[model samples]
Target: MTTQFSALFPGLDNPLILKRYPDSSDANLQAWDAADEHLLKHLDESGMLPRRWLVINDSFGALTCALRARHGDTPIDFAADGRTAHLGALENLQSNSLCQQEIHFHDCSQLQSLGNDAAILMKLPKNLNFFADTLSQLSQTLRAGQQVLIGAKAKHINQSLLTLIGKNLGEANASLAWKKTRVIVVTADGKPRPLSKPNRWPVPELGLILENHSNVFAANKLDIGARLMLDNLPVGDFSQVIDLGCGNGVLGLQTARLYPNANVHFVDESAMAVASAMANWALNKLNPDLGKFHWDDCLSHLDAGISADLVLCNPPFHQGEAITDHIAWQMFNDAKRSLKPGGLLHIVGNRHLGYHVKLKRLFGNCKTIASNGKFVILQSVA
Candidate 1:
């Protein structure tokens, strides 16, 4: 694949390169989007000198790298929940030979101390609830009259996003479209707005109450895939279990209760997901010491020798706006690598995803545990 980049900026380009797995012959997509370029251009035109800048949700480090290159010696603090984004940013910076010392990276959950002088540059996230939560966090850190610039595709920068910004922060205005991208400028009003509470609802038959933040999948209801997996939970003395893409931690929490002796590991790529899972775990009075939470890309960089006896997963089929099974492939591979001998991997997927095929290839044996109209539960032994 060609590493084509915007000529307007010399050092910035899409650096997070990976082919869509299981379909390697398919074209690799660019990591950075046009919205990233618009934000960089807005920064240039505003003559914004390097103050403490906070860049949020920068996919593949396009904005952060470009800003660093343009304002060399200026400090930029980058925050993202995705491990891939963090790693990709670092790799891109290195490829451009930029000093890493000037850039600060933070996990999304620990963003309380960003300075008052910090000018915020954000990419509108796909999840509006998560987006709103981020705005609430910004409201706490920003001083009155501070500028916050948000970049998004013109289609996504609608009245609703602007309304959310105005309600939570201060008044917001959108810039003229440039290459079908728009920059939204919001000024902090110094008045603190109440953040939206996580949604909690009952699953009556299961005798469980689940909580989810706005951006989580199936926030309003239990997902069909998860339901299928719940019904097909393996019958074994699972002493250590992991919910690999544990969105709301429902699967892990249930596993923890069912196998009281087991330690549950909850992992997801979203900071908000991790936060919600932690909250739900506490809300259910699950032993904090019994569960380990990691915001990660699959199980990459997890502690070695920390294999699990059973792993539950409902792997995501897409990454960002691109629809691909690469993440699911990675999840399956990671499960295989992290399971002890004779350990089990239980998974639920859309019927058409054909996870059985992938599991069969990875584990050398795959069993259909249960199936409904649109979802299926599959099992593999390591």
Candidate 2:
């Protein structure tokens, strides 16, 4: 796919390069939306040059990359949870041959330690609860009068988001729309805002309580697909197990409990999901070292020589706001490559997704393990 970018200001185009998918595919579907451009333009017009700046949730590195490009070697720090964002940002930076030495990277969980002098530029995340948590964290670090600017599509910048920002941070104001995008500029009042705790729910029969963060999938309850997969776990003893696209790490934790001697790997693309899984794993008293938690896009960064005897997956059919099976396709392919000879790939998916056809084509064999009206559990043995 072609790397396409749009500059909101003169000499300040945001670089966007799609990875792991061809440009000819549905990949070039607006990397930086009008909201991103509007935010950049606002920053340029304001000429508010803070010595240190923090950017959060800059999807595809657009905001961070553009800021660095405009400032020309200014120090900027970026925080994000998704492995894809980190990889994409690095790729975009390299593609543009931009000097990235001054850019600092931090995990989403470490936002509390950031300096108050840093101006926070954030993209309104799709999950409001996560957005609230981010704001709450900012509340702790930001002093009175410090500003946090948030950009989002005009349609998404509703009163609720603005209210949440005000409730968590301080007084907030929205700027006039540009290119159908609006920026909410919020100043810190130095009023302490309590962060939301992870949601806890019990799995009655399993006798396990799962703790999920707001951004985690099926946060308040067990996913029906995951419940079916848990009930139909393969009978064989598996030494090396992988829970691909593990949400809240329910599947991986169950596997760990069932096989205390086995090593279980939890892999997901969401930062909050991985954080929840790690917390739940600790809460359940599972040894942290026994479960390898990866905030990754499927198993892309997983050790290449490491092979799993059993790979359990509830592959996501979408990425961000787009509904597509490309991720599921990639997950299955990665599972096949990561499995040892005669290893098995177990998956639960919506029945209409036609995962059987994809598995059949990839592994030359597919079998139904279980099925409900809306979900199907399938298995493919290498």
lDDT of 2: 0.83
Which digits, one per residue and each the tens of the lDDT, describe model 1 over residues 189-265?
A: 88766767889988876777888876677797888888878887888988889899998898998888898878898
Model 1: lDDT equals: 0.80
Cα lDDT tens digits, model 2, 151-248, are: 88888877877788899989889999888889989989998788778899988888788998867899787889998998998878799999999889
Model 1 lowest lDDT segment of ten: 16-25
lDDT of each: 0.80, 0.83
How well does candidate 1 match the true structure in TM-score terms?
Answer: 0.91
- RMSD in angstroms, all models? 3.0, 2.3
* TM-score list, all predictions: 0.91, 0.93
